[model samples]
Target: MVTPEEIARVPKVLLHDHLDGGVRPETVADIAERTGHQLPVDDPAELGQWFADAATSGSLVRYLETFEHTVGVMQTHDDLVRVARECVEDLADDGVLYAEVRWAPEQHLREGLTLTDTVDAVREGFEQGVAEAARRGKVVHPRQILTAMRHQARSLEIAELAVSYRDRGVVGFDIAGAEAGYPPTRHLDAFEYLHRENAHFTIHAGEAFGLPSIWQAIQWCGADRLGHGVRIIDDVDTSDPDSPRLGRLAAYVRDKRIPLELCPSSNVQTGAAPSIAEHPIGTLAALGFRVTINTDNRLMSQTSMSREMSLLVDAFGYDLDDLRWFTVNAMKSSFLPFDERLALIQDAIKPGYAI
Candidate 1:
């Protein structure tokens, strides 16, 4: 059995975490008061519980409504920086050594900051958080992934912004929103542009939707990964262990080595998967798909990388080796340069698990 303490000490890599979705409850309260945004609950603890409860609506769109308050408070340059800084600190405290925190810059323009300024502000915050973590004898290498809202028209513009900041702390790009109606094909131009620039990106597909979403994300848009690709299980026939078979889409995902960023708690909260035990991640992992676990929305899901792993351990009986495998898969699938990814796995992740 993998103890919670051991899981806490294990170095992990996170590929699909949201920036606005992981703000500290106390910080949300403070920002709400300072920014004049009224939250449902005044106390930080109750506010956090409110978010977790509100997200339990079992609809992805409804679950996202909880972000209104969090995003409402995050409008100014200072607010963005503070949220970004705290994101790193919180993930570092949870034993995440490497994380890609994603958000939509266009959403933060309410206070008049330009998209470029928003990315720059977040970069500064990440640097500050890294320094602070180092001072506290922890090492967390954080990267940013600029996400374009799929239901909106700013994807091409957001894609351009992401490519412009590639050499900086920005590592990759993504499209996130209600995945059912707004398919990845809606932003074909953005994905094409990203491909032409050799930029990496992931699409939020096969979560609230089904195989068609996953197919388009891979076949049409050329996504490097599938965010919450839990719905890929729909195409998998696992009734018989001896005769298990995968549909064409699932086979392609596994044979092509595409990474599936599976967020178990968020999947349950959004009704993508029934429960941790029934999550497709177990089947995908057993059958050799490059499955990586993530915390899609920490506040809404009320989870961390540790908690996600712990849930899987409790449900699937995964040991340290399984945890290490998922961490390495996430590190390998990360948009970081290959050399850096290799070093983190060899020097950091492997050693941490060896303990």
Candidate 2:
């Protein structure tokens, strides 16, 4: 059995981490205190547990409500920088070699910062964090994924913003929010624009909803990846475990090598799955689907890349090889350039796992 410490030492790549969702509770309290914002609790530790507890309510809507406090405190440029920097440092400490940290810039405009300003601040923070981590003998490469709220109508603008910042720290674009009423086709124009620009993007689908949402994301929106695609298991008929049948959509996803960004803990917290042991990742991985592990929301789920991997280790009897497979899957699925991705796989990830 691989211990948690051993898992922490492995090189990992994260694809679906949210910037605001992973804010440090202490930082939230500090920013709140400085900016005269009210928090549910004053103690950082308690506030942290409060987020976890509130998100554990087993509804995606309720789980997302916890972001209000984190987003509330991140309206300022310095606060955004701090949160972004801390996110990088924390991931570095957990041995994440590459991560695409995503957040909706529209959500941070309450404090008078323009969309471009928010992106610049976050880029500055990432650069600082990278330098600091290197000083500590840990190398981490963090990229930005600009997300537009699907419930809102700013996807086209966000897509433009992502394309504008592509040469900068930003690597891709995405849309996130409650998935039921707001279909991905609502943002079809943005996806079309992204495709025209030859830019990469992902869509949040098959999490709170079902196959229809996944179909819309892939067929209608042409998402390069599916965020929280835990619900794709709905298309897999596992009645005969020995010969599980993949429906058309499931077969297409597997045949096309579509990457499923699966967050086991977050899926359970959102009632998408019963528990880690029962998560669709086990079946999906066994079926040879391109499944990558992630910490969807670190603070809300109270998890890290290491914790997620460890949970899988316990639930699926996954050892270093399994963990390496997940890590490689994530790296291969990342929006990073081809040469850079290959270099990391050859130099960093493989060497770390071989240890």
Candidate 3:
């Protein structure tokens, strides 16, 4: 059995995490104060609780409302830098040895920072943060996945920017936003450009929407992975008390090996899952779909990798084998180079289990 303490000490890889959504409230308050941005709530604890309450209320509209404040606080170069650095530190402390953080650069251009400047600022912070972690003997490495909002245009430009920065810590591309009515096909040209350039990207789908969204993200837009993808369960059936199995869509996703970044707490908060006990992650993992656990919005979900693992431990009674499979799934789905992925599995993950 994988004890909660053992799970915390297990080296993990995170493939689906949102940079803006993960910001600590204390960081948000400091940025709000320095930039004179009026936040609805000033106290970090209160603000954090507000987000937790709003997101977990089971309404997608209410859940998204929490981000308007986080986006506001992230409008300046300094704001971007601080959040990016702190995010790396926090992930490192949570036992994530590697993570790919994504956010839309165009959304942060309100306060005089150009699109390029915003991307660079975040990348600069990532570099500085990784160095600082190394100084403290932490083996955390992070990569950026530049995103372009699905509703707004400029995805192609962001796609090009991501490819350009492939040498400078940027690893891939992504598109995030409200899923309903904003199909990833709206960004086909951008994905086509990324495909032509041999760059990697993932799309937010099967979240706050249904199977059609997942279909468009995979078949139409060519996402290498599916973000949230909880609604894929809609296509499957568990009506039977025993031997519940995948539907066509679920089978195809598993057969094709499309990585599903499953955020249990976030899914519960957004009503994608009824609760941790009902989350499909355990079932999907057991069924051999490439399921990777993540903290979609740590602050809003009031979760970390440790908490997510702990919930699985208690709810699903998963053991170390389950944890190893989840870690391997995340590592394989990561846009990091193949050699590095293998090295992490061999050096960090395997040795941790030997303890």
Ranking by TM-score: 2, 1, 3
lDDT of 2 by residue, 1-355 (tens): 9988789899999999999999998999999999998998989999999999999999999999999999999898899999999999999999999999999999999989999999999999999899999999999999999999999999999999999999998999999999999999999899999999999999999999999999999999898899989899999999999999999999999999999999999999999999999999999999999999999999999999999998999999999999999999999999999999999999999999986
Q: What does candidate 3's lDDT look like per residue over 1-355, in tens digits?
A: 6777888788888988889899999998988898788887899999899889888788877888888889999988888898999899888888898999998898898988988899899988887788888888787889999988888888999999999999888899988888777889988999999999999998889988999999888888888999989888887788874787778888999999999989999998888899899898877877788899999888898889989988998999888877888888899899988998889889888787675
Candidate 2 is scored at a TM of: 0.99
Q: Model 1 — which ten-residue stretch has the worst lDDT? A: 235-244
How close to the true structure is residue 219 of candidate 2, measured as C-alpha lDDT? 91
Per-residue alpha-carbon lDDT of candidate 1 for residues 1-355, written as tens digits (9 for 90 to 100) = 9999999999999999999999989999999988789999989999999999999888998998998998898888898899999999998899999999999998999889999989999998999899989999999999999999998999999999999999998899999989877889999999999999999999999999999999999999999999988888888898897777999999999999999999999999999988889888888899999999999999988899999999999999999999999999999999999999999999999999997
Q: Which stretches of candidate 3 lie over 4 Å from their true place?
A: none
The segments of candidate 1 whose C-alpha lies over 4 angstroms from its true place after superposition are none
Could you report the Cα RMSD, in angstroms, for every candidate shown? Answer: 0.8, 0.6, 1.3
TM-score of 1: 0.99
Worst 10 residues of 2 by lDDT: 1-10
Q: List the residue pairs that clash in candidate 3.
A: none
